[model samples]
Target: MNSALTPDAVVAAERWTAHNYHPLPVVISEAEGAWVTDIDGNRYLDCLAGYSALNFGHRHPQLIAAAHAQLDRLTLTSRAFVHDQFAEFCHRLADLTGQDLVLPMNTGAEAVETAIKVARKWGYRVKGVKPGQAKIIVAADNFHGRTTTIVSFSTDPDAHDDYGPYTPGFQIVPYGNLSAIAEAIDQNTVAVLLEPIQGEAGVVVPPAGYLTGVSRLCSENDVLFLADEIQSGLGRTGETFAVDYEGVQPDMHILGKALGGGIVPVSAVAARRDVLGVLQPGQHGSTFGGNPLACAVGIEVIKLLEKGEYQQRSAELGQRLHAGLETLVGQGITALRGRGLWAGVDIDPAVMTGRRASEALMERGILAKDTHGATLRLAPPLVITADEIDYALDQLKAVLG
Candidate 1:
């Protein structure tokens, strides 16, 4: 190991890596559970959880143990030959989703891409739409991923800037508006892709009955309903999925983030066999998709989420967390919105901007990042305890005060 690389790692990364993300200047070295230690050995609670990837918290023993065991036995055999752990992962993930099939992918973006491909293929084959003319409807303010096809429909200029010629055949509708979704549909529209709650758009929860209304509309319109649960699923919303709040079932589910249990990059697209089965032998695949190591780790993650009462913990803790934050209303806060443990705090302009508040909180040893100008999101790991929540809130109050 290089000692020099270990010390000035942040600067070195900035010098070499692409200037893509405007990340906070924190060089995290080691982490365990819901806490992280920087290179300087200063500890801070992990509030963001890798944007909800570490729902089981950092270095969960089960996940780490699974990875270690798999590393010794096997890592990658590729899709060229079937591996032992792949079937277990696929079956467990499909059962957990109550879907008939699962297509494993290595990252959240890949899972989204898989979903897009499945929807398009199904449109042409099952729905009798022309190959080149199939259209997918996406919601406004949606954050699916950064692929060229994914970003082509993004409403964010920053995400789509200087990237063209974009993919065609996608329509946009105002989020949380069932009427807009219904109006956007045409004969060629194959699917309606959405995030039940817009996490990147500051954890915006839609109006009541919006999801069920959209589900019913899609059922009537024959448009496949795809839920981008990468950020809102796996118990982040105090339920197994944000869609559970409405008891709505989407035709296809794009899931990632916490599926790896903060141990590896594991994601999957789940749907009925008919929808996902549109892909033939050469239609879609990834080299590392469903490899042994990721499958083993992913299986452990699912087992933990299912066997343990993590979702219930998220629900109960979410109420306490939101109630605690509600007490801060009219203090330095302007607005607050969220579901489960996820929260978007709007600060008064007179007090501080979101960026400034984030910086202040960092100085006080609590790591949270800003979303929009005045909104800061708090999505701590679901494994976080009550005492930790109080401590994080105390830091928030102190910094805001």
Candidate 2:
């Protein structure tokens, strides 16, 4: 597909840096499309896609070309001066997201942080909420980011405990439970932030009508529906966004991960003018946010999405993936859930732990990751072909047995 890496570049692959994969012992030296070659020359089919960060696969030609072109011209202005790529990046993103405005940031965490600030400001300025009384509702077992404020509302002990004293003004509700959300809302509630499908929580897809219900509840209570689509957006879930399955439009969108086409880091929050308009100059900003290089890569990402082929591949191949996974349920998998090319397989604990199974899969030349003890997550790059998908499934089946 993308011949971004020539033969010379492939041979020049660097050694793995230390500590990133501590104790895993897998030293990846190079990658192309849906496969990675370890330093010792072993190749593995990639199933995690760098936690969905590399949705377009490694070294996609278009994304790399944009990055190189931008490098030759301009890189940074620090938001102090306007650059040529700024408006075009933001404008295309706005149009893509079907929103009135967009505020760019450097990472998913930064985008979520921006949304939080915007929501709080909107609560006080526009919603007429009293100072220091605003609250945002979040789902349980959600992974927004590692920021102190984000982890403040995390239900996972690993992410929550010892990270305190935690921030306040947020409420936790059961994911996929509309009644719980309705019961938790109050006059001071500023927004309801959720992942359309919780990624870190073993790719948990909410119950039917869950997304639309949340949208309705937010509208009824005048609270902004903030969809943290960082992992679930950008055609990873077969649609532009996971929420599109229900045709629900969130008031604010928090996007990242694949937004930079797995090259540079680019994140943004898209919302109506009345919502993001609450922020004044100097209220909050990042020096590297919306930089020329990030924007150039982001524009290419948007253009690729506009083609609709990747999304179609995911949707079609996803059916093939799930169909294969479905046959393994009760044999080794306790449960299976996901959308598009993404899946969460719950290994039977009696057979082996998810970690051990992942190691077994790794040995079989299929790379994947385990989450929360017994659940294994698979989000292969969209560039992954049907044959590769079958090969991965065969390896997984052998591992489970």
Indicate which candidate wins on TM-score.
Answer: 1
TM-score attained by model 1: 0.97
Residue 65 in model 1: lDDT: 95
Error at 290, model 1, angstroms: 0.6
My TM-score estimates for the predictions, one after another, are 0.97, 0.95
lDDT of 2 by residue, 90-173 (tens): 999999899999999989999999999999999999999999999999999999998999999999998888989999999998
Score each candidate by Cα lDDT: 0.90, 0.92
Q: Locate the minimum summed-lDDT window of 10 residues in model 2.
A: 1-10
